[model samples]
Target: MGNGYLRFAALGDSTTVGLGDPLPGGGWRGWARLLVESLQASYDVSFCNVALSGATAAVVREQQLDQALAHRPDLASLLVGVNDTLRSTWDPDRLHADLDHVAGALVDGGATLLTVRWHDHAALLGLPRVLVRPMAERITRVNEVYDDLHATYGGLRLDLALMPEVTDRTCWSIDRFHPSELGHRALARAWAERLCAAGLDFPLPSLEAGGGREPSWRRDVAWMVTEGAPWFGRRARDLGPWAVRRALAAAR
Candidate 1:
């Protein structure tokens, strides 16, 4: 595995798409790309990332799963379920079923699957106090799904929730949802470390040195006004009503 060529594919939502950490030439350089670059230092690696912002688990299963499978990747990463957690109609069991299918298929295809437990974003996002517990519960349940799948199939799992640095303000973008550049670097380093610990040898750098440029307040403010506000408005128009209806149904 180490000497041969490697194909890697990443599938998920906004985080995997790297919303906060934009590339100078456009698009994003998320943790998936960083991990791939690290591996590229040694192995002949070809990488593909098919992640979309605002994508739910079902959407990922429907859209990206087939593409990832077609790539016949030797290594695959799945980082979904956050968008599902945000929805009012979220069903952890259903989400788990979809993810189980994805994991099962990739493993059956002989790909080494990798996935991470979601961090508690609600706490850092400054959500209304009333919404925090519910959101936290949803996140916990989703992570349990990841854990269960990993236990059933041999794969690597990183518990980002337990990592305190992930919750720090510096680690997040102005939107408070996506990771900042520094945060992305932290994630990449973590993944590399985890992979190495799991016995896959690769040249990984120290977390402290060569961290990317720090985001400035001016850029942050500009992004909030330009991108964040529009994103919030879209979510309100599209997702809010659907979520409300689902919440109401659940209450009934």
Candidate 2:
């Protein structure tokens, strides 16, 4: 049915990069890979994951969009903007414009565009109390942009807020940012369900969470000390003052 060969290209940030779901031999085998495997039973699926770590929406447009489009994919998933919300330079209009351009191109090129409405990541991260409201507002605006894009282009949009497992600690990796192996499998299963409902003739991916390394408390602490702390420090430098200013303005 259809083309018999499905070209699926993933464009976004680290989550799409599969950071939380590492392969045994190395590298990441995220939701995109799992979804592709499910499609294998019904069609020849060609997958390209061009998502980068810490990529903003603008970054995706400028960098990854061309790479994804070059593959001439029949299915495209754009799951970015959380990085944008974290930065002081976040601009919803610009986010909308960048996403619009990417979504428009995908739709016009005959690809089934996929988007995401992110959840309350700030709450989950337990960011500083000062930043909670502002970050939530930013995520809301970002979701609004996705809403506009979905209204215009008409595609599958996954809303992470509805996923009960999103708030579960087990669903998150050590970084507490990216999804764990179980989380990635859940996401892949969700996508498979959506695709099947949309008439994709593919077997559903197994919901069983296996094949990834188990989490270790020692590894978690090590990563937090090495990777997480530095990342938080960098973001605090930028987002801290911004949050303070927003708070002050709100008080006024």
Candidate 3:
């Protein structure tokens, strides 16, 4: 609670950057923004969202962490590592170390850190059979690191893997990774409920989906061509060789 108001910082990757939930005029609005809005009813809040698209754990540690810490947030959320799993550079030890640094810094600074256990993104994305196991293994490792951090830091955590809504196609955009507007609304509601349950003096945000335009097939197709394809190409270039090497070692 610096500057006479509660400060909230959000850090991670595209999801936190609000890529799936487009604003009507232009920009993006995600669950974190919704959560901050909810908090404003009871308390003045200063919110900073430093998450970028396609960022890895190392990226958050090196680039976003300092920005977040500067806000001196009363609460902060960290959700990342899916992009790391997509790259050839994926390393569990390095991922853990980066996360540890980010989490430790926030908690040490007296911020209540929020973490998440990721879902099986490979299954959700319906990735190629050859890539599924490798991706799943990496996601599992990421979740394990989150579990350790939650235990060590004694903060709130959301288990997306166990959330049945996460499996529903309606919760996801066309890409099946980022959540749709309704999905983001639900996530914000859930976080508010958790904070209230943890004895934070704030009312829960409504679970209703509002102010969101329904997604259309035409728009979805356009996004697939313009955004999705290029993103997939970039990931494939890096992830392909690593997957091949893993497959060869398995065959041996």
Which candidate number has the best lDDT?
Answer: 2
Where does model 3 exceed 4 Å of error?
Answer: 1-4
After superposing candidate 2, which stretches have Cα over 4 Å from the reference?
none
Pairs in steric clash, model 2: none
Q: What is candidate 3's CA lDDT for residue 217?
A: 89
Per-residue lDDT tens digits for candidate 2, residues 214-244, read 6678877887898889999999998998899
Candidate of highest TM-score = 2
Please give, for residues 1-252, the per-residue lDDT of candidate 1 as tens digits.
Answer: 445588988999988898777776666787787788788787789888998888888988899999999989888888899888776678888999999999999898878888988888778777655456677888999989998998998788778877776768777788988987777778888888887897777787444524344456897799899988887676556556665655677688
TM-score for all models, in order of appearance: 0.88, 0.96, 0.95
Better of 1 and 2 by lDDT: 2
Kindly give the number of clashing pairs for every candidate: 0, 0, 0
What would the per-residue lDDT of candidate 3 be over residues 1-252, giving only the tens digit for each residue?
444378899999998998778877768888998888888988889899999998999999999999999999889999999999998877899999999999999999889988899888888888787799989999999999999999899788899877878978887899998998877877888888888887666666666766555567898889989999899889888888888888899999
lDDT values of the candidates? 0.80, 0.89, 0.87
Overall local distance difference test of candidate 2: 0.89
